[model samples]
Target chain A: MALFFRLEEAVSDLIHDGDSVAMEGFTHLIPFAAGHEIIRQRLRNLTLIRMTPDLIYDQLIGAGCARKLIFSWGGNPGVGSLHRLRDAVERGWPNPIEIEEHSHAAMANAYAAGASNLPCAVFRGYEGVDLAQLNPNIRTVTCPFTGERLACVPAIRPDVAVIHARRADREGNVLLEGIVGVQKEAVLSAKRSLVTVEEVVDNFGPRSPNAVILPKWTVSAISVVPGGARPSYAHGYYSRDNSFYVKWDEVSKSRESFLEWLRLEVTA
Target chain B: MSYTSSEMMTVAAARALRNDDVCFVGIGLPSAACNVARLTHAPDLTLIYESGTIATRPAILPLSIGDGELCETALTTVSVPEMFRYWLQGGRITLGFLGGAQIDRYGNLNSTVIGDYAKPKVRLPGAGGATEIASQCGRTFVVMQQSARTFVEKLDFLTTLGHGRTGRERRELGIRTAGPQLVVTDLCMLQPEQDTCEFIVTSLHPGVTREQVQQNTGWPVRFADTVAQTAGPTADELAVLRELNERTARAHRSDS
Candidate 1:
């Protein structure tokens, strides 16, 4: 069974220091509020994971909450560089954060493998690419029958997976619609999961054809945080805050402005 | 009215698409080009976004893959795993459109890091779906502004395989699909030499000279024996492109 709590209480109870966490969202439904809550609570030394560690990861990294980042891509999306992420990697201003990079295919497969209780994810990837040279975790395995070579990366079973969804029922079943990323796999692949939703409904209404229904038992805790995935939209709830993304370029460029902005918006 | 070089490049890239082509679209130039194609020549073009929106027909240009317009207008949406495992790796997409920070003679891209991977001067966004898209899509079309800084002789890191290996070597390694077919730049368009798979200038956009193209490239650039000037954007094409831009601006205005 899953328990429901306020966003602050949930973050305090579920996340801890030195935990490997995946705040999974592709470009949509990125649990910004929950991420901010984690920052507010001053969780430290987290190994943060995502396919594209955009604004939220930038915030987490900027706040000195992350020890490492495992991701495929990191950027401000349609703008230019993520300055805070760049600051951490290039200059190590807040703290020296380690990085483990993979391609989108590998990350998706790894998450699936974790969900399936597999040791490693096998895929036809990294062929003639140079990432294999740098990352030791990326190696090759031969198929049993065909004898063809394939790339392999260890399964990503995180300590905690956090996500934002459109809605959840009283029974704790969650509904996700529109451009659903690896949220389901991220939830299942983790030892524990935290879900934030736009609302806690009496019953999940008639869903769209493509909605993902995560039943109660799969989740550990549910937090009803309206506008949780702000800046990154929550599908039916709101549109993506494009203006804010454009503004982030300026605000995140310098340390003073970034820290001030974080202090005012995220921590305050 | 005369069009700018950037607009010419976008129009040319858009005209390259045919109807019903499943284009795995990226952000920036690729997105603009594909959407232009959708609104005009390639109305039936199936736009597959990395965010798992398949056959998306957005009302306006999407700011990013996760733009709400994409999800709201998509024919159907799937999870990220399904998007990669079934659609991309399954080789269902007909084309992949990309933009990159650096590209080598072989068209191998480097969006990862600038000087060194460990100690970097500039840390670029690493490969998202670009690695698989460049490798697995039936073919890829790269759109970038022609400059020595971007069109490099060698990449800092090979993030995606374009024609890094010859056909024989690729066959030996069990890799298939023509990697990058055409690279459309503001100055000229390049096609790989059939034998060497080295990108060579096949056509120059109107008013752009071979000398100008050569001056911008890092390596000694080669040209086709019969290099031709790309036909300027047609009146209808310009009209459509302008309308698309206007609509995008209007869309963003209302959205904000």
Candidate 2:
């Protein structure tokens, strides 16, 4: 059964030092509040994983929380670069965070493989690409059945997974609508999962076409944090704050500005 | 209508898509081009986003690939894994449209880093879906502004494959797709040479010179035997493109 807790309590209880964390969201329903809570609690040495590793990772990484980042893309979405993430990789401002990059296809397959209890994900990718030269993890395996060779990457089984959803039933079943990217697989692939919902509702009401429901038993805990996915909108709850993303380009430009912004954000 | 060279890039890229094309759209220039094609000539063109939004017809442009408008407007949305595995790798996408920071003569792209991968002067967003999109699609089209910086003699890193320089044919290397057949840029349209797979100027945008194209590309550029002048953007195309862009600006700006 899934338990309900406040955001802080859940972050403290679920996340720890040296844990591999995946805050999975494509460009929507990103759990910004939970990421901030992890920052506030000062969790350290995390192997953070995500497909995009957008703004939240920027914050977590800029705050000196991450030991390594396993990601495909690290940018500010429609905006340009994630300055803090760039700083960490290029100059090691906060720390020299190690990086293990993959393509989107590989990350998606890896997460699915983790959820399926598979050792590695096999796919037809990285053909004629130079990515395999840089990353040792991208290797090839021959299919015994067809004598065809395919690319393989180890499964991404994280220690903890966090996400923000549109709603959760009183029974703790979470509902995610619109741009539901690897959240379900991330949750299932993790040892523990925490979800922050916009509200706890009596009924899920009617769902649109692109909605997903995570039943109670699949989740470890639920935190009802209204507007938890702000800046990175929670579908029906709000719009993505495009201005904030534009502002982040400036705020994250310099180390001093990032720290000052972090101090304000953490204190608030 | 007097369209800017930047608009010419988008218009030229959009013209590449046919009515029956199932385009796997990238963000930025590719997105705008794909949407413009859909609204104008290729109304039946299917726009697939990496966010799992398949057959999306957004009223306005999406800043991010998976913006609310993309999902809500999509015919259907799958999980990211499914989107990549079934729709992409399963060989359903006919065209993969992309943009990049740097491109080489062989048509390989570099969006990863501007310097060494280990120690970078400038770090860029690594490969998202570009690798598979470039590899698995039936064909790929790259839309980026023409410049010496982007059209480089050598890439800092190759994030996606087009065609290997000499010995490594993408087909011979077990990649079945026609990788990066065309590159639509601000100044001219580049197509791969039949023998070398090196990008060569096939058509120059109106009022652009062969010398201008050579200056923009880093390599000692080559031109097609019969290099043709590109048709200017039609009045109707410009009107629709402008409307789409204006609506997108409104939606994005108002949200802030």
Positional deviation of residue B30's Cα in model 2 after best superposition, in angstroms: 0.4
Task: Give the alpha carbon lDDT tens digit for every residue of B1-256 in model 2.
Answer: 6899988899999999999999999999999999999998898999999999999999998989888898888998889999999999999999999999999887889999998889998999999999999988999999998899999998888898888655256878877788889999999998988878888899999999988888888989999999999999999889888999999888888886
10 residues in a row with least lDDT, candidate 1 chain A: A203-212
Interface RMSD of 2: 1.0
Candidate 1 docking DockQ: 0.79
Question: For every model shown, what is its TM-score relative to the native structure?
Answer: 0.98, 0.98
DockQ of each: 0.79, 0.85
Error of 2 at A201 (Å): 1.1
Question: How many residue pairs clash (N, CA or C atoms closer than 3 angstroms) in each of the candidate models, in the order given?
Answer: 0, 0
